[model samples]
Target: MTPVSLWNRSFVLWLVGSAQSRFAAALASIALSFLVLHQTGRAGQMAVTLACALIPNLVMPLAGAWVDRIGLKRPLIGANVVRGLLQLTVGGLALLGQQTGQDVPLWVINGAAFLTGLSSSVASPAAGAALPALVAPADLPRANGMMGSLAETMGLLGTFSGGFLVAAFSPAVAILLDGLSFLLMATLLLGVTLPNRPEGQPTSSSLWQDLRAGLRLMRRSWVLTVMPPLVLLVNAAIGPVLVVTPKLMETLGVGPRGYGLFLAMEGAGMLLIGVLFASLGSRLPLRACTLLGFLLSGVAQACMWLWPTYVPLLAASLVFGLGIGLINTPLGTLLQQGVPAAYLGRVFAVLSAVGAVGMPLTLLLVSPLVDRWPLSLWFGLNAVGLALGGAVWGALMRIEPHIPALAEERSIEQPQPRR
Candidate 1:
């Protein structure tokens, strides 16, 4: 297949729909928390709302099994529909509260947040399953790179744009925008013409069997197994930084807007790196780049605390963003190309599910430390996380020296020949 022949009319239409959906999702999920806080003026409630979105990740693998069984389009469409309705409900409630001159209870908004998260969980597996069908094996790298870039780009824009929209209009308008975007995307999905479907009924077998199958496949492939952990290991530290960052920034008088700016810069860095990956048109030495990127990330995390001035903090965020971009693109490219199509949804689900476990666990420690310990101590601990991720992934490379994708030059193994 041509490296990019799949870039036809249908694919472009899908991209437009997917981009808008993602933009809307980002606006609601990433930026919506700030809106909730603005309305309620309660930080703890905001955290709980965010946690509702995160907690569903643990159940998403099972959702993946359902996704694979149902095939990509059904689950994708179903999830979008659910999310659209949920957003519309939330927006209407926010409006209702405003009209009645009564506050929307934190519990009420959080309940909406839970449904939003559940729909996102259901949609994730379908998205993974859809990409391979959308493009040929030859174009997997380009396709995945574009995907990564678009996700990060939409996230950055929606996040930054949410603030502007809310400031210009109001949270009600912002959320209504989100609801309409999802509704539109779901409608457009009717025309997508996905390239394939799962072979049979969406399966519901023994839980142990599904979990075992997913794990077995993951363990057998370095790209599936080692790389995710390498990435997750870094995020173990990142979760804390994310949790404490705004607080720290506030303490240092950088203010909330500055904090948002720091996040935006980090996202921009990821977006830039993603574009480079999409268009590079050559095989990157995955192992070398992964190692260097991980190390750079560790170094950047360590330096973030040292940057006393707000300007330096912005620079540090940029480095963190760029490093993340460099590491993740190749890793995702390998996963998409290496994992079997039949198992792709489950494999990615497993990765997302387990990988997310680190963040909350790290959060448990971050709250206590920041409250009692020095900021330097927290930053130092994060640095240790980076070194550990770099060290562990490096060790895995040495041990699994022949891991197919690790060879310096790119050589994509074709999907296993027909049985």
Candidate 2:
């Protein structure tokens, strides 16, 4: 087969559409928060509404199976369309409530949030599953890197702009824009046509069987099994960062604006590192880069713990961002390349679900610790965990020169599941 060009029209369209959808999601998040708070003024109600949005992730294993069964093409388009209409409905309701001096019922908005999240959960994993089909094997690294960068960029853009939009116009206007963006995203994806599923690959007879099969597949691959736990730990470690940043800022006398600049610096590091991964990632040694990223991230966090000053902290944030980019880009590319096409959706979904479990747990454990202990202790703990993860991945990388190839070999050796 002739190698497909990485910059082909289909890939470009997928990239743009994915970015648009992500940006829309971020906008919706901000707009929804505004609308909920505006309507209820109760922090508890706002928390419930946000929690509703996260409820779908608990079912991602099943959702991933559905994605695999449906194939990527239609699901991606349908998800975008559903999200678009849902956001538009929510926005219209918000506007209606505002105009009539009556708030939209809490239950109605919460239901909408849940449905929107359900669709969103599928869209994300499908994007990951669909990428390998859109581009050549060798280009997977660059493709994944670009996609990661685009997502991060859009998220930052949406987060920053969403507040301003709500202030200048209204939350409804910001949400309406979110809806339109999804529709635009759907239009862009309409042009993408994925390859048919390969013949003789394993599938299951029922959802339960399929779910087990997905777990079975993950259990068979060392790479798949290890990555998710690392992801969970890394996420848990970062949770405290968000909690401690305010206190850190106060200690350093940086103020709110300094905190924003600090975040921007980290974002800048992420962006630059992403660009590097897109351009040079394929040529570089994956294990080395991964280890370096982990080391830098851990060291950066530890630096903040040791010296919580303005300049040192800012510099640490940048390096920390670079470390994040390195870890995410390579990890994502490896998964996309290593997993079988038939199981990609399930694998990614399961991985995400596992990590999601840790986030709330981390928050539960870390939030209280922040109030009771010095901020530096939590920061130091995060740094240690990250450094430990780096050491683990480094050892694994050394054991296998080519992790993807190793995964492929192991996958082939495992017997196919019965239909």
Candidate 3:
């Protein structure tokens, strides 16, 4: 008998399309910053543009609820199409203005960014929810791992190439590439046929009720409550690390090369771990991976405090990256297996919203302290917090009864006729 393969056509296509879209996003992220800086040369103006992009995060929960009602395929496709058009519009207008010796209006650029962000807010959750429809329950971890690796690598490429692309060609060109990527991804996704709700499942409900249902799920699950705060705290630490890492590097007599190397190592570690999980993750216990990941991350941070050096810091970066993969991948699998398909979009939206808020808030709080406090202080504090968070998470895992939602694991194994 032939062995079954998880890399079915639908899964492969989804993976490729999603990776293309992510790469485009990464490129756009870099190009957007450059465009703002080059045009205005004012930090305040850049902030306003950034804020415009981020403000749409407030709509994520509503968008998620809407996705649940409408289902995934249409929403995901439409979002890509809309976002592609928005970027194309911005790039075309900018190019036309340049040729005509007239500047594109600031409002146009900012409005386009805001609209794209809004479109993505809907697409992100829909994509997450759609995955299980394409692959078997047992294959989710491997699929997610592959997806994560592709996204990370593409993002790294985008970051690495963004500045060079801007220098070599116009920002308009970079923006155009980003737009084309989205359109191509949409085209690929159009060919995919995903499973729909099984018969007897009620048709779509009201958005408000869907919203409440999603919220109720969160309220009921101890894991859900634990995730948001833990995510927030960990993300918050990134702000101070960004500010302090450079100073620390200088003290070690290394320049941007060291910084870049550290980032490369981290990305490589994440990619390596993702590949391992893709193959071996099925045998691993989710709870064990989660706890170990948390502990590893905490220990990595503490290493910085215990012995801060160039080599040690590099090693810490690798461990930190591995830890992130362990935490995120298993958590994602758990969520996919646990939630009813209808509620998946909304839950992911809430997760994204928490991250959006947490990341920016961390920057706000830590930016001021960078000049006043030593780098060691931040590292020590983050280390302790991560350790405690891990311990708390482990305790919760032991104490909390099996969540009813997660009992749907077997339901995910049931075969559905393709739509």
Candidate 4:
């Protein structure tokens, strides 16, 4: 079969819309963080607001099932519209408070955050599910890489824009921009076409049944069964690194500027790898690339633990970023290729939820002990986990070929109980 162009109209629209939305989200993230801090004057409240945003991931399974039942376009459009409205409301409230010399209610901000997050949770699976329909399977890796690279670039720009906007105008203005961006994203998505479910073939199974079927299918496939937990492990290991980095930098006397550079190095590495993937496409083997990512991440983390100096730490961070880029693109392609399109929403939702839970849970357990323990301990632990996880993943992939194809899994009409 002839390869389809990666820059087809549907994908280009999706790419631009997604990049703009992500840019807005990154801008809003900074604005929201500073806004809460300025108003509440407490870091605790800021944490609470961020936690509110994450709470919706817990409900992603339900959202995913809904996406599967009703189809993708409506969810994508509706979620963006709702999120746009919510952001605008929050921005309006902040502006009102600014004009009146009063503080916007913390509750209102948190409530808006929660609702917007819920909308995003619904939209995410729908978007992922729609991708297979938008591009040929052979082009998925390049498409995903392009999307990742552009989103990263946009996010970095958005972060800088957020600072500038807040400094030049106000957090309220930046937030309003975010709101408008979402509305624009929704408008753009309206023009993109997706494959529709067959005419007159309505879903026979209840949403709960469909969810169960998704789970059953996952259990039967070695690749699917291993993916969620592996993602969880990687996230869990990485979480403490983020949490402890500031303190470690302080101890090294690098200050905030050095910390920023450290992060920039990582981002630079990821962007470089993303571009490589986009350019090379399927020339790279997914399984080998993923395993190499894990190994690089583990080795990088070990370097951080062993050296703990300014230059070495920066170098390690760059390698870690490259590892992450390698892991994310291939794993995403693996899922898009391995799973039948019918169950894509549910599977992606489950993985997203699992990954979401990992970081917070690990942070909760690790935070209290951070000041008491040596920082190298966290780095060492992360290194070990990544290395072992990679080994286990490689073993699982060996067994994956023996298992029957996930496409053989029954449709929602013929649901099977989990073994």
Top candidate on TM-score is 1
TM-scores of the models, in the given order?
Answer: 0.84, 0.80, 0.78, 0.83
lDDT of 4 at 64: 86
lDDT tens per residue, model 2, 1-419: 21378888888888888787666666665567657755654434554565566557777878887887768877788988998898898889888877887777888888987898789788867877888888898888887778877876876676556655665666787788888998998888878867555333465578676666767666655566677888778766776566466446656765334555576566667777777878775886666777889998998999988987789888998899888877877877877767777778888888886776665466555544665677777779889889888977977775555633323323544664321
- In candidate 1, clashing pairs total 1
- Candidate 3 lDDT over residue span 127-239, tens digit each: 87888788777788888888888876875666456545655666777788899998998899878776444222234347766676677666667777677777666666554
lDDT of 1 by residue, 219-306 (tens): 5555456666765676667765654565565577754456657777887788887787778724766666678778777777778767
User: Which whole-number lDDT from 0 to 100 does residue 220 have in model 1?
Assistant: 55
Model 3 alpha-carbon drift over 4 Å, by segment: 1-5, 37-51, 92-109, 196-205, 239-264, 298-317, 361-388, 405-419
- Clashing residue pair totals per candidate (backbone < 3 A): 1, 0, 0, 0
Q: List ranges where model 4 is wrong by over 4 Å.
A: 1-4, 37-47, 94-104, 163-170, 198-202, 240-264, 301-315, 363-384, 401-404, 408-419
Q: Sorted on lDDT, highest at the top, how do the candidates line up?
A: 4, 2, 3, 1
TM-score order, best first, reads 1, 4, 2, 3
- Candidate 2 residue pairs in clash (backbone atoms < 3 Å): none
Residue 39 in candidate 2 has what lDDT? Answer: 65
For residue 118, give model 3's deviation from the true position in Å: 1.3
Q: Give RMSD to native, each candidate.
A: 5.1, 4.7, 6.2, 4.0
Candidate 1 has a TM-score of 0.84
Once superposed on the true structure, which residue ranges of model 2 sit more than 4 Å away at CA?
1-3, 26-51, 93-110, 166-172, 196-200, 240-264, 300-316, 364-381, 404-419
Please give, for residues 1-419, the per-residue lDDT of candidate 4 as tens digits: 11277677888999999889877876676577667766764444554565577668888987887887777888898899999999999998888888998888988998998898799889988888887788888888888888888876776677556656765677898788889998998899889887555122225458777787778888877777777888888877876776566557657976444555576566666777778888998898888888899999999999999998899999998899899888888888888887777788889999987876776566656655766688777899899989988998789767764335663333534644432
